[model samples]
Target: MTPTVSGSRLKSTVAALAADRFAGRRVGTPGGRAAGRWLAGQLRAIGASVTTDEFPVAGVRELYRTPEFAWSAGSTHRRGVHRRNFAEHLVSADLPAPRTGELAVADSDEWRAKWVLAPDLGVAARARFEGAAGLLVPRGTDAEGWMPKMIAGPPVGALPVIAVRTGLHDEMARAGSGTVTASMPLRTVEVIGSNVHGVLREPAAGSPGVLLTAHFDGVGDDPQQRLPAAADNASGVAVVLEAARLLAPLLPDHVGLAASLLDGEEAGARGAAHHAPNVRSGTYVLNVDGAAQLGDGAAVEAGGPAHDLLAALDQTGRETGVPLRAGAMPSDNRRYAAAGLPAIGIGMGMPGYQTPAETADRVETATLVAATRLVVATVLRLAVHSRGLIALPHKDELQREG
Candidate 1:
């Protein structure tokens, strides 16, 4: 029997997870911890036995306040507004103190000890600005006039890199050259992130289980701005929670179902990496990353020993009237695949990815329902198929039949 998912429930969950109170749900922050606790409560309400796994996350940078950038043009001071006129590069190094120096173009040799203004900061430009005091690189805006936010991955170099708007760059160019003052104060600290793991049934020896997973963390909010990453991941978690509610009562006694709401996925899938080792071998994992919008149905990426899993997904989609297409999603699914588990990554759509414009209202409830139905159908189909395979004859019996 196909379990009915409530669209209203999905919308409410998305709203709760993406609310301003959650503080963008960034891992290692107070708001992030609050979001995790809220999600754990939701899981318990859905009748799943829940536990949390904690992992250490280091080098997380939070903007203490809006960064300030100003310059002198013929005795008139010009300032750039944070997020509007300028933004910070995630990999930029923290300045010991406010830097004040004459602005120079990247081509000028004097820029080595001055604030260099560059059109873009590619690898070559970054290399050239190695010895410079700092860089003012212009970043292109999207159609919505919002600057794309970036996550600090690995440390690029020692130089501080700030992304200014192209208009600001033009203004500085028109001024010829002037003394520029830029201040970016960031708080770098380490904290522990938690992953909520809930199971409907415990697995028996040599029994294969099904895993449904999603990351609940988003990019932390700016000091003065709200970045509710609803579509990027909150929507996904909402759908997964709905599926867990529907599957708990319907799953067979021999079939095991587990859901992992992970953290630190925005920080390079750190939570998934930590949880992968504890996954039982031969588990089939379905990881949902985005589920608010649909673009030609759901996008699915399969890896590891996923032949059976892929077939079940296709059949389930056909039976459930959900569309499925092949797509690559380099998310937490890859972590499970790397651990030699059959894994598939699913994404419906990401309307406003990693930006301040992302809001809970933008998440479509119908898309969430569709995603939930697809996941439930796939799990049921796989559970039956796996049981059949386990019941198949041994090699000695097959040889006798031959």
Candidate 2:
């Protein structure tokens, strides 16, 4: 007999996964890697096929070596001009260094100028001036005090661009020689990444395959700190895992119940974008991300024929006394929807979103379990409904469409 996912088990899983040490599971960090590994282990325990796909991100640097700058102050050289601490700065390449009379922005630049003064553009400007591989941004100030704001300039060519702390910029300002030397170490390579999958493939009367997806990666504001992404995503991944465990045995032999723990959803939705072109026709999908809070319900975001799927899910929630809300795509559901495939997104409730409390203790276990059951039953029922007219395309038919 297949193991049934129980509330007790899910609770334990949630508690263990949400432990303090995980540090919010932010993407591109050690914590995020730990979260991904944990997710892989969970899916493995449930017999899922797993594979990690690696890709490269351009113009990114890791805090490996700090660049030093110094200048001559009269006869005495006042050493140490600029410095900062950050894992990496996203910058553009091909910018020049500052020389006497080089254009520079002060605290009085217009907000629009500041807004457009993005690091990418700064790299471009620096490159235009110095013809360097990248730009060294000593954090500068705007109209306000030390705050995060974009720096504007032309597009920096292939060179990498990065932003350092304002303290560093002040040091550069003191370079009496009217020249500044900035240095930065860059990280460019292929890193290990992954995509988790669970499938219940079988033959059913005429049922089309159904797919469910959620990205396990979390984005973080701080490059160094661990982001305990409890609400942003850990919750969504949990829902998908629980659903797979519960529905595995009940799926019809001729039908397919597939779940994916996609990677790189934070880095430009690369994972979802990869899955789009490969979407199978006649396949239905439910994409869940973000945590759900207690007292609140899961939002439904599918329209068109897919709306029927949402309605069916909502109806099942009602029958089971689960409070599920309706809404639009907020996750990977956009992938399938954009592909013209039937798809929807389901999310949890939270007070301050993207924070730990956002995925608070309000996820109704009973409702979640009931929701899974309903999804399984509804998929089967819909498959049976579509079997009659949802023609199975022959090789010729597929070739013609292709």
Candidate 3:
């Protein structure tokens, strides 16, 4: 009989990881480090041989305080809420000090030293406002008034960019000559991130093993509020932990089980990039992300020489009555795939991704249980096949045969 994963345990684990003390689990912050320590402790408690891989990451943005934005039209003034009303761009430049300027439309020359408010600004418009005080764009929001949190991307223009709610933008538009003042103080820091590794069983020489992985880091919270990235990642980590606990006693000697709780996934997948090259060549890797809100079934994306592994996963899903389908998940599994390893990425669902509304309460316990069951079942199926596993031909061997 397969060991059961307790729903209460899964819920508690998610609660612990998504608690306020973790401060959204951002890579370089004190809260992030605390979360890592907590995870390491949990892995050790599971009686698995645990270790950590430490690495240095640079150019990580740390939000120090609540960014402020206010617009004044003559004698009337209004302030924008941090997350609900507006949010700072991920790559926004640090304001040396508070700056105030009149709100002007994009096409007007008055945007020289003023806050340029527009529905959308194209590349040419961005170049035109290279000397402007700042740029403000109106963005759509969900029913709860939550806007999409920005992620770090390519280099932006010199002027800082901020996104405000469409209502706020309309208000600013009505105040044709309103003065807008904004402040977003930030600091770039070099920080050490760690990947927690726990081994359930050691593989024999020349024996291929299975790896379970999930990223635990999230977008750090703003000064005034917590992001509580429960669905984005904590849900997945909870499932992995439960699976490890249940599989420890049943893993076959020739087939090893290893789990990695990675960091800096939100910061351009730095943790995955650092780990992929070091993975043993023939190891099978499965990365679970966003497993909280399951919609019909789990989404699985496979790459490289993973025919046998994918087939086993599909079979296990069918036998266990869990739905599985092909989908695109551009996550840590890609790192392993790039290194010629058989890799699969799994995604269940994420309701409020990278936003403040992603609370622990939103996580579905039923989804968590199903995801954990699927992983456990898949691992057991792989173990049974490992005894007679035939290695796929190498590229060189296939080319010679052709």
Top candidate when judged by lDDT against the true structure? 1
Residue-by-residue lDDT tens digits, candidate 1, 1-402: 334678888889899988989989889889999999999999899888999999998877767777878888788677877776778876677764678888887667566667888776654355454567788888877766677665546665466778888877888887778988887766566778999998878766667798999999998798888899899899999989988887777666677888999999988798999999889988999999999888688889999899999998898788767788998898999999999999999999988788887888889877888888788878877777655432322112211000
Candidate 2 lDDT trough over 10 residues, lowest sum:
393-402
lDDT of 2 by residue, 1-402 (tens): 332446555555555555555554434556557766787788778776665555443222233333343334346443342222211244444223422222233331322212111233533553444444334455543332322211122333455444545554455445422333344443433343456666646346455777878887654333333334554565667667877765566454566677877766655555676676676775788777654453566676883258667665765566545567666545677877877788877775533343323343555455445445445445544555554422221212211000
Off by over 4 Å in 3: 74-77, 119-130, 388-402
- What does candidate 1 score on TM? 0.89
In candidate 1 the C-alpha lDDT for residue 61 amounts to 71
lDDT of each: 0.82, 0.52, 0.80
lDDT of 3 by residue, 148-263 (tens): 56445555446677778888888878766788899877656778888889887778887768899999999878777889999979999998998888777767677778899999
TM-score for candidate 2, residues paired by index = 0.60
- What RMSD does model 1 have? 7.2
State every prediction's TM-score relative to the real structure. Answer: 0.89, 0.60, 0.90
lDDT of 1 at 78: 77
Q: How accurate is candidate 3 locally (lDDT)?
A: 0.80
Best by TM-score: 3
